[model samples]
Target: MLPRRFNLHRPDRIEDAVALLAEHGDDASPYAGGTELLIAMKARVLSYAHIVDLKGIAALRGVSARSDGGLIIGALTTHHELANHSLVLERLPAYALLSANVANIRVRAAGTLGGNLCFAEPHADPPAMLCALNAELVLAGPGGERRMLLAEFILGELSTARATGEVLVRIEVPGLPAGTRAGYRAFGHLERPAVGVAAVALPLGKGFDWRLRVGSICGRPTALAGLEKAMRGLPEADALAVLAEGAEQAAAAVEADDDIRGSAEYKRHLVGVLARRAARAALGMEALAA
Candidate 1:
């Protein structure tokens, strides 16, 4: 099957791209990487009369350092590029590992981070890890720019907070505090994940600060607030104990969906298992229990 005929507009500047989308309104969509958009169009799930190509916009590419020791990643960056970037490897190796393992080589080579987030696929990977890292997003539009946390940006499955004319410009990640460690783990039968978990641990006085996020099975990446609170400010041994005891309850509390991926109950079980493994991995231990 083929997509319906549509006009392609290649815009070399952000302003031009924004104007094209704003003018076309619901008839247009910003195109980058095309890993998701092209597939949907071919399947007849979505149609756009005007496709605004953003690859010509030079400003929407590359990786740079933040003065605060974090990273500023261009929205158009490919998964493969991010997986191998020196700064990304040095500052957020867990995220790099996740990127390197996203889908397969072909997707990694062509899929853009911006496109993945904008597509808001429930079984995607980056959103969970980025949420754990407390990443912020910048969206450009005719009215100017809007900034929001990645968690807030994703409203539901295949939906985001982006207005019709907005373009995701760059993603900003805050510097992890000293003694912080992060890890990610996922389980899936094929190219997409069924369940994915991300954990972050930071030393706080005599205890530790913990952040845990579960994705893929849910409509949006979900933070395990109850579990985090139970483990926060506890000694390493105590925290691990709390995690072991509370992981299942926390996973069960999440709002999940039953689809081709797996049943909601089974996906919830994977979340508990992955959460433990991710936590251990973050603390520099083996992911599997002996």
Candidate 2:
């Protein structure tokens, strides 16, 4: 299969890129590493009259720490770059670990985090971790730039909140407050995850407060609210024993579909298992109980 014929536009400026997209409307698409968009084009699932390349834009590349101790990652940053970046490793090790596990070597080399988020593939890894880690997305358009939470950016399966003529400029992961740790765990039979869970734990007096997310099994990364509330301030043994059943019930609450991946029920069950394991991993307990 081959992509339909299209004009390729190399825009050195973000303003020019936005102008091209605005002019071409639905017929134009932004091109980054092309790790996700090119595949859809090749498969004939998506088509475009113009492919606007953003790689030449100087502002869309690099990683730097914020004055507030958070990190700002450019939209063009590749998975491999983040996996080994010293700043990411030192401040957000869990994010670095997640980056290292994205697809295989070749895809990681060419894929951009902005593309991954804009593609909105449910089985993709970054969104889950980003949601759990409380990351914010920066978007730019003709009207100018605005910031939004990752949760608001991801609307549904294969969809995002990005408006036409807009580009994802960067992503900002806030520094976790002291005593908080994040971890990610996932399960799938194939290259992408079928069920993935991310946990950010803030251990306080006695039990712990957690931000837990279940991805892949749902249309979007969703918080396991019931299970999370139940596990609050509880120790490992108490959290597991008390909330194990709650996890299953919480899994039932996610929006799942029965496609080539697996049955809805099967994926729902996996969410519970992965959530428990991921929470335990975040808490530095045995990953999976005996």
The best candidate in terms of lDDT: 1
Candidate 2's displacement at residue 41, Å, is 1.3
Query: Mind giving the per-residue lDDT tens digits that candidate 2 earns over 1-290?
Result: 99999999999999899999988989999999998899899999999999999999989998999887889999999999999999999888778888888899999999999989999989988888899878999998889999999999999888899999998899998876677777888888888999889888877667678788988887789998887788888876787786577888888988888978889999998888888788777767743211
What do the candidate models score in CA lDDT, each in turn? 0.91, 0.87
Would you give me the overall lDDT of model 1?
A: 0.91
Candidate 1: where are CA atoms >4 Å away? 287-290
Candidate 2: worst-modelled 10 consecutive residues by lDDT: 281-290
What would the per-residue lDDT of candidate 1 be over residues 1-290, giving only the tens digit for each residue?
78889999999989889999999999999999999999999998999999999999989999999998899999999999999999999998888899999989999999999999999998999999899899999999999988999999999999899998999999999987878888898999877999999998888866778999998887899999999999988987798899999999999999987888889999999999999999988888864211
Instruction: Give the number of the best model, judged by TM-score.
Output: 1
User: Each model's TM-score, in the order given?
Assistant: 0.97, 0.94
